[model samples]
Target chain A: MMDFALKTFGLTKSFSGKIVLDNVNLNVRKGDIYGFIGKNGAGKTTLIKIVAGLLKPTAGSLELFSSSDLNKQRTRIGTIIENPSLYPNFTAKENLRVQCKLLGVSDEKVIDKLLDIVGLSDTGRKKAKKFSLGMKQRLSIAMALVGDPEFLILDEPINGLDPTGIKDVRDLIAKLNSEYNKTILISCHLLGELAKIASCYGVINEGKLVKEITASELEEACKECLCIKVDNIEKACDILENKINITNYESINEDTINIYGDFPNSASINSELLSAGVGVNSIIKKDKDVEAYFIDLMEGKTND
Target chain B: MINLLKADLYKLFKNKSFYICLVLSILFSYMGTMINFAYNSFSNAQSMYSLLQMPELNGIYMFKTSFRGGMLFYSIFIAIFIASEFSWQTIKNIVSRGFSREKIYISKLISCSLVSIIITFSYVLVAVLYATIKSGFGKLPSHFVLNLIRMILLECLVVISITSLFVMVVFLIKGIAGSVATNLLINFFSGDLIVLGITLLLEKMFKKDVDVNKYWMFSYNNIFASFSLSNDVVFRGIVVCVLSLVVFTAIGIISFKKRDI
Candidate 1:
């Protein structure tokens, strides 16, 4: 009944004197598709592992369901860290049965339903070793859903999937959040894919949480701009600054400039540029995607 | 803990290697009896002069021989089973499911002990059947039967203790090949020969009478040998076996809890 599904306070972990996660404070509210974004070895997996209770933190505290007793709280959570933890010799259904046993769920119907949910119901009698990476990932997801956990933590759940597989998993994640009201803590390198379903975002860099913002906040942060391609970039800047009194703009290169402020009409700007002998080649509106925003955040170009 | 044990048992049942090891152990047990019978027959046909012609073949002797020879197979099975968890990365799933590492360790130990017990019982059953068919229950006395049952139970404890040692090796090494190799080396090479060699060297160097057998009761020849089952030897063996079980189980549990995976 906690407001937040998960919250970490100064969660730090080190390996052999090398810091993997350094004072990372993260939060995932109820029914949030919290997209954890970072590059490979950016401590994403390390943090996820700590949250899953697979690795104890060297320092810090984590609360799941507002309880600091992670071992007890972990029963209400499911996780797939790094690769899908599965027995290759067993079939997908068999693997799930094993997971069901671990979770103390005896209902065979639940296993069947989960397999159907993950699009693995048709894989009859095929051992997991024979499964492709995508199939294996789906099966891992099914395994994680065995006990119908209220909170799910998945680390790079779509790493090795094909485009269709990625879409399936994305839709499944969305469905789990929207329909089942499950709070998800997911990390993936593909920011574009993450952008499709993530309701909240957390950017991690060098083992530190650099930014935590909602999707709407990210949308507002990625400001819209008008990009103009001109023959003389300096002349165009001078005309916009001196004639039109628009100084809140920056030149991207020799032929391009991004105008940040709003102007009345493109025709007037074009006419002004033409009168000033600046050849306007093209005018286009540019919108920043989550990937670009993430890059900017990681590179310290954006203020938190 | 009970639920965890149930899950561990489920995994063990699903493992094909468990059944394969059981089958091999049974065959090895029967083969031991057959070979002994063949050797006795050959000696009688050749009329070779011997100190004791055709040593008595009883159910207890056959069971003891078969259990000792089959111990390695069971140990290897346990190693591969534990190692497969690491290789397949399924330990993460179990650990993340909120079971304490201590419970997980205890569950595996119990499951592996069950496996050892099943295999030992099967080996003994086959050995008993073979002995009955070959020798018609030789020298069936009530006291001897009671003693044999007592010895079999004690031997089971010893086997479980040894199997715990293998489980510890598997957890410590965390790899199939390394654990199996280390288990084999310790189970076979470090038993009596190494103890005798060390004793002889110490005696030669320091001129002292070092009782190797008294110090080391882990040898196959001493622990599994057919003897009178004295009160002193039985008590000491039980103490040593219990101590070994505690040590191995402790090491395995501690190592497993501390490991990252």
Candidate 2:
């Protein structure tokens, strides 16, 4: 059986009595790029911090790989919490070398290889303090990758990056997931970019995970809802159910019943309603993006 | 762990304030040399003996005095540097790289102690060599060698204890300004208060009416009283060093482990 890479059950956290994360349950499976999506202050960073062992959860159980030794599991997990933590005075090679030494991995050649993997091999002699924001972000990634971890958790990894830098980081993350076969959990504000790489996703809001779905499932399940306005409400509801054979419709008011289905087949549906003694008032179709999908999830629309 | 220590040392060496502190030490120590020259030029040996109330003046004592002077302040500066690691957010990088929190804390402690040791010894070395050139050889006090060793060891302990105490504070406080300011302030005020309280209690219990002023006794400044200890008194200094190390390091490690990074 393939095991989960990370799991949290009913995780709750508070800072000085102010609740940030409340009853969050999340699980990321092996070889999966899990997108942790949320707006700002939605407890994304808080959840990440708890998972990284940088914060103590007030209430919850966090399990990372079924292992006897936590230290051993920690060795396989690489995390960049909020920002890349590094010694600004050290060189890139020197930084990785130190990390290697701490993990008891004495191979010196791997330092250069790790830096090259992060595209920071040419940043020779420049201190991390002197690096530009994008370069610093890259160096931080290089630092996280030093121990050859099986799972990488990055919180807003592309935060503050330019468009080009964002693309570079996105490509790097893709490479890490595909070429290196490492599982990744990344939280970001860039929904479209996240949709590109994430195979699975968990939408978090107010510290609780509202929904968890695979990319294919989300594509299938979170489809756009079609709205239609007809003259005769009774006939429209009857024809839509009997003739159209699509039952997914909600009564918006006396004259409108919102129908959600395959796209704008409004012409055929409206004609069917009119022939059934219903007058066509208007038909409107709304396209739902991932952002709207999240809004729906937060609004308790998971049932639909 | 040693790798972290090495990185800590590397980071500390890059700070401009550290270099400036050394320059200030050199400037202060050289002023002692100028005073010695002035005293030698104007005063006869008899007048010097009567006025100073000491056997003789030598470069080693002048150097030792100046070198060891105000080391507590120097150590406070070191505390601020260690605290800055967290403030600058660089500590996150090292910890994210799979280094244990314990290893990182110990590394900073070890690095700070070693730096204190080196700077203390270096200051002494420069002062002694310069004094020897400026002033002719005076009688080498029998206690000089042991005193120098004790001074170095005491200085190291003082640095370790103070830095570890500050590490605990930083771990609890989670910021540079709070840890540095609070630690230096508390150490400055309570260090003397604690030492005085202990010294008074010890004196009362032992029934020793020993004049306190005869020796630099029972305060943070006593950390510099390396040459004052006789072979019989060496064990006392050991007790002080060990107790401080155990207590401060224990608090530091425990607090760090419990703190959310």
Candidate 3:
């Protein structure tokens, strides 16, 4: 069995009488960058907070490092939930030192190293209050790394960053997972950005875990579909359905049809259409990206 | 628990509000002494009843007066220190780092008590130094110093009790302005006065002379006054202080643990 770094079963949360998360089951294996994708008010932060031990679930159970005692296991994890929890009056270095003290890490050298890792080595006594949003986000990430935790949970870690800041954090997250062997569970609404680094994804919508799929499985599930344009689309569909024995296809418009599944012989289909007096105008393969796949999952077009 | 304590202490030392509180408390204590000295000098000059004729410069009187004068600033200090955690969202950070809610609450309690004690003693030190310089320490007998120590220790308990109450407020209100406002209102205005008012009303309604000291546990003046009274009253005061500390701390811890933040 692959050792799971974090797992939640039937994890639910509610504020007052409103349900925010409903029976969400999530899993993050060791050494995987698990992307938690959800929209606003989708309970992404709620779930992250519950896993981070900052908030307790109104119902359900969670396991960290395969241990049912999440409180004890929380020491092995680090988190940055919602906003960066920082003392504005303290400098970035001081904030990291405070985190170090909280985690009981005695090494003075790790502070500088983490600052350098987060590209904040030159903050130089400037208080966090004066730092920009990007700088604050980077410092929060650096703080999360204070304990050298095995698991890192970042909720919208790059929410308001510029393009460069986004890329920098993306690269840093990838490096932390691949190079440092850290298992990361990151939540973000930006599917494209998350797609770049996430090894697996958990889609949450309306306070429910809609789907969980590995990146490769999602890639396969979103495989390219062959699109064909013809003068007589109905006759082309008849030929594709009866002659070619292809039932996994949809008529897009009056002159276009999309064929799913493995039909490597596109020329044969065109030839078959032509022989049936259907003029083949164009043939193309459209690849579905992560964004389209995510939309499909959110809209309940695909089975979980 | 040790790590939590260290982190809390580190934050306490780094907090500018704590320093501001220290400075303000010291200045307030010195200002009280200087006002008294000026009054004594003016009274002595006028050949009226000299203010120095009153036994107010001894260690016991100075400790009591300075501590009482510093209580307002002490409440503010607790409010700022605890409420800033909410304002800054650092409490969430601490909670996320694997510390139990009880541990975090206890750590804050210990750290706040430590800062309160430091502030209290700093005030006491300044008051004593001023009194000695003005009156030459000749009137401060050995027993007076001993009683001063006893009162200071009892005053520390009262400070801790007040700190616990503030902690409960911060956890309940969970905001800087709300916690500070509520803490000041209770500590400065309504905490003891309401209790005393109710006690007097009951005494009048019952048509019997009731020993109001028993119900004056929240009243610092009464508690401190009891120190000079019978040992039984002092024991009762100490019990009340300890009970307040325990009750407030329990409420704070339980409420904080159950809170969503």
- Strongest candidate by lDDT: 1
- Superposed on the true interface residues, model 3 gives a C-alpha RMSD in angstroms of 1.0
TM for every model, in the order presented, reads 0.87, 0.80, 0.88
Best by TM-score: 3
Number of the candidate with higher TM-score, 1 or 3? 3
Better of 2 and 3 by TM-score: 3
What fraction of the reference structure's interface contacts does model 1 contain? 0.80
The window of 10 residues in a row where model 1 chain A has the poorest summed lDDT is A295-304
Q: What is chain B's TM-score across the candidates, in the order shown?
A: 0.89, 0.72, 0.86
Tens digits of lDDT, candidate 2, A1-304: 7699888879999989999998988989999999999878889988887776677789987777855344447678887877767667778787776567655567888888888888898988888888877887887787778768899999998999999999999999999999999999999988888988999999987777888999997775556667677767887888888888878777767887777766347778877777778888788775678767766776556533
Q: Model 2, stretches more than 4 Å misplaced? A: A104-106, A224-286, A298-303, B10-24, B35-55, B63-67, B70-77, B96-100, B141-159, B166-174, B177-232
Docking class of 3: medium
- Ranking of predictions according to DockQ: 3, 1, 2
User: What is the C-alpha local distance difference test score of each model?
Assistant: 0.84, 0.72, 0.83
lDDT of 3 by residue, B39-100 (tens): 76676667655444544465545655666556677678788888888888888788887788
CA shift at A140, candidate 3, in angstroms? 0.7
Better of 2 and 3 by DockQ: 3
Residue A260: error of model 1 in Å? 8.3
Q: Considering only chain A, what is the TM-score of each predicted structure?
A: 0.81, 0.83, 0.83
The positional error of residue B227 in candidate 1, measured at the CA in angstroms, is: 7.9
